[model samples]
Target chain A: MKVYNISFQIDPDLEFQWLEWMKNNFIPSLMSTKSFTENKFYQIKVNADQSPTYTLQLYCDNIELWQAYQELQANDHLKELQYTWGEKCYYFCTEMQIVN
Target chain B: MKVYNISFQIDPDLEFQWLEWMKNNFIPSLMSTKSFTENKFYQIKVNADQSPTYTLQLYCDNIELWQAYQELQANDHLKELQYTWGEKCYYFCTEMQIVN
Candidate 1:
């Protein structure tokens, strides 16, 4: 399986709203695509700024399905997030192959 | 539980040896402490340089235990890694709180 790990640097004040939106809207929509088999969210601790870092790992069956999700759904979802959150949130994504 | 997420940027050439050492030596040694309940290693995909990025997630029952591990074992383990790998492998760590 493959994992799409996305880390978000979000304003601490908006964390509640972000988490609620993700739980009620974003995650369900993504999972509905059936491209991802499972997902996990973590609030990461970094010794940087006060901004909280969160990681969302989505497990996919293969790269092709992941790419398809990116092309068909991810772009719009990302755009929506940016539009709604403005500069309050920023993110980066990394795809990983499970070796063991 | 708390998750210690460590990401390593290693020269791709040394990946095989790194994986072997981690699987046979590092992980087992760390686990022997009984501090971490579980572990996972993933090879991350990024569009950066030729260097490969790997993330090792270690699950601890609590932050206190994690801190104790860092003080007693992690320091030495990290030192040994840097000593042996030098600039070939560099890593950064983030501790995460699982909310769900």
Candidate 2:
């Protein structure tokens, strides 16, 4: 299986609103695509030098499926988020393989 | 190698300040312990129902070293964070085994 680890930097002032939007809209839309098998959201911790953020761990059967989701649907999803968050958010994606 | 994925939810209003703290204080403190082999931070993506966050992916030689870190020093680290963020932060930790 292939796993994608995605992180986001959100505006602290609008955190609750952003969470509501994601639960009501973003997650469902992505799950509905049929390419992903499972997805989990995580709340990050703030250390002495940084504020907290959010994480989405997506599991797919293979890299091809992940690529399909990205190439076919990610842009639209990203556009929607950009409209809502504007410049208050930043993110990165990493691919992982399970060994045990 | 064993990998630990740590995610945190921080106060958005204090993000920049927090980032500076992490870069200068928290991260340095952890690295000083000399147990973690490598570490990388990622800005998470926010979906419809979630807000942006941060992730710390730490690499080590094995689970024993990770355990040493937790039992030896994690509590102090956590306490420092508590002092800074109060109730505006949350986090989760996951262990991953690399396959490739």
TM-score of each: 0.90, 0.52
Where is model 2 more than 4 Å wrong at Cα? B1-69, B72-100
Those runs of model 1 whose alpha carbons end farther than 4 Å from true positions after fitting are A62-64
Per-residue C-alpha lDDT of model 1 across residues A28-89, encoded as one tens digit per residue = 87788899989988888777666888888899987788889988888887887788888999
Would candidate 1 be rated incorrect, acceptable, medium or high by CAPRI criteria? Answer: high
- DockQ for all models: 0.87, 0.04
Could you tell me the lDDT of residue B59 within candidate 2? 75
Q: Which ten residues in a row have the lowest lDDT in candidate 1 chain A?
A: A44-53
| Per-chain TM-score of candidate 1, chain B | 0.89
Give the CA lDDT, 0 to 100, for residue A13 in model 2.
76
lDDT of 1 by residue, B40-71 (tens): 88888777666888888899887788889988
Scored by DockQ, the top model is 1
lDDT of 1 at A47: 71
